[model samples]
Target: MKLLLLTAGSRGDVEPFAALARRAAASGHEVRLALPDRSGVDTTGIDARSLEADFSALIESQGVSPLAAMRSLRDVVRPVMRAVIVNAAQAALEFRPDVIAWHPKVLSAPLIADALGIPHVLVELVPVMTATREFPAAGTVTRSVGPLNRLTYRAAAGAGAMFRREVDEAAEVMGAPRSRRSSAPAATLLPISPAILPRPADWPESAVLTGAWRAREATTDAAAPTPDPALDAFLAAGPFAYAGFGSMAAGDPAARGRALVAAARARGIRLLVATGLGGIAVPDDARGDDVFVTRSVDHGVVLPRAVAAVHHGGIGTVQAATAAGTVSIVVPFIADQPFWGAMLHRRGLAPAPIPRRRVTADRLAEALAAAPAFQTAVEAAAARMADEDGAAEALGVLERLAGRPRNDALRHP
Candidate 1:
């Protein structure tokens, strides 16, 4: 089978899909991942289609704060997102994939798949993509309130409305039916561990909650020696903690690094912080015996060795921490981060969810202090997740959908 994956957003958003692409390829399926150009995605062995766009520059302009960016979303991202969708349509026409698995942020995926006469699976990394009375939207930290809870589902997909006309126009150009009521994906795949979030009873039968995704293999950086030797030595030194924000560009990465150093110093815990795309700034003198700073390390290699993991509550990071059975100190920056943080707290994996606004040095110190309490929950969740293979489950969903009637949006689970 030939699989085309349309992915957008940050590293955390793209990594799991890339992992799945790798898995699919290993199983004798040809896979191609279409992502925006210069996004710093690693695709050494996989077939990747690069879309033309300065996605990095766009993100830099918007800042890493999800809430701050959301304030001007329609004004800032609408045009770029539209352009990307057009690019996606072109890619669809060129690749002509048998099945398209797409990120929720790829608003034009359904249209592309519909035009190509294939099945499109809505792959959600987080549960907030669909709304239920179970809880408020992932972007929020509130409980349900009547009809508003359902509106969150609309809110997450609301951006689709902004591009609906263009998508329809593209579908027309591609000779697809224009009367289609909605461009919703053919089926939904929630690639999260049931250990972290069990499937909700109210979710449509078309939606399925596979286990959390953890690639059995590892990818290394050719540019630099990775899982960096220095980091390994630091972990061997003693019980240390790791702090990183993945793709969330911090307000001041270097300053954030300094604060992390200070907080760890105060709490009397050794710390190793990963500076992703310069998420943190480390002075020449800062990389010393006790408090270490490095560019990036594989969570699979580092998290388990550490006592805890401090990071933005990205689904990828959450799953990594859970799989490592490492305690989490989630400092959410925006979007579904708060929801992940809350879930960690409610599940007893963390003491609390620290919003970026409240992530001062003292607060981080206290969060670190409470790390040990998360051990029991962390171990249990990891054990449960270890038994699941989300990539395999996702592949099964795609394979089954591929054999069924192509245009039936409501025919799946």
Candidate 2:
């Protein structure tokens, strides 16, 4: 089968689908990843295809409050939605995929697939997309209430559907019948494990959590893929913490580095920071034998050995830290990040979330030292996560629609 994956957003959003593409290719299917823009992504094995626009540029690279980002993001979709659908539809024509797998935010894919009369799957990276009384909004740590929990779902879904107007335009683009919201994709795949996030009873039968879409080799042996001699020396130096905040730039980065170093000093631990696309600045003036800051480090290799991990509370980082049995300290910046931080805390995997605005050297130092006794449960969570094969499960869903190697792959147990 030939599968075309459509996605946009930061690296976290694109990577799950890329992982899925690799898994599908391994099973003898032709896979190509279609990006709104593929800049800065290592497309080595991604079977990469470009839709030719960067979402970050559309969204903004500077500090926009979460509410402002949400408002502007929705507005951008309204004006540019037609062009995006047309461009992605054109790209799909070039790939001529048998199936289209898309991230939920990439609204154009489903519309284009419907216009082309092809099956498409929605790949949701976070639980926010699902409506359920079992949980409240994905942007907040709201406790479940009678109908309020479900209302949050409705609001999120309804707001997202505002972009569906482009489907009417899609009809003219493909010269096909107008698409209907009632006719959603054939399936929805969630790349998170129930061990970490239990499946909500309110979620439709079509949606399934297949664990985090980690590579088979990664689950089996994380450190083997990208060994780092400098990281090895740092780890050997003493117990250290992993601090990574990917692509979430704000505030004085130089000061941010000094604060983290101070935090590590407060806790009497070494610190290793991954200066990811987040624009974190760790000046040499603040660096010493105990503080090591690198622009890149294979998180898969380092998270496992660290005593604890502190990140910007991306869902991907949460999953990685949990699977490595390391405790977490979430300093949320925006969007559903606060939700993940709260969830991890509620689940006993971390302390209360520290909002990016409240992040200080003293606060982080205390958090690193005051972490709960969550090692046993987190270790258990890791074992359960390792047992799940998210990519294989998602592939099974696709094959069922394509009628290739089909079986009882949908049963959650």
TM-score of each: 0.90, 0.88
Quantify all predictions' global Cα lDDT against the true fold. Answer: 0.76, 0.74
Worst 10 residues of 1 by lDDT: 218-227
TM-score of 1: 0.90
Q: Taking the tens digit of each residue's C-alpha lDDT, what string does model 1 give over 1-413? A: 88999888777777888888988888899888888766655788989887665556666777765575667667776666766676777778888889899887676677677667677888888776776777777776545566667777667656567667666666665667664654467778888888888777688888888876546575222232344577666777787889988767767776677778888888878988887765667676555677887667777778877788899888888888888888899988777888888888987888798877776788888988888878998899989887889889888888887745475544321
Q: Report how far residue 351 has shifted in candidate 2, in Å.
A: 1.7
Count of steric clashes across candidates, in order: 3, 2
lDDT by residue for model 2 (167-268), tens: 566556656666544246678888988877888876889898888887655542443554667667776666789888876777676777888889989888
Give, for candidate 2, the lowest lDDT window spanning 10 residues: 404-413
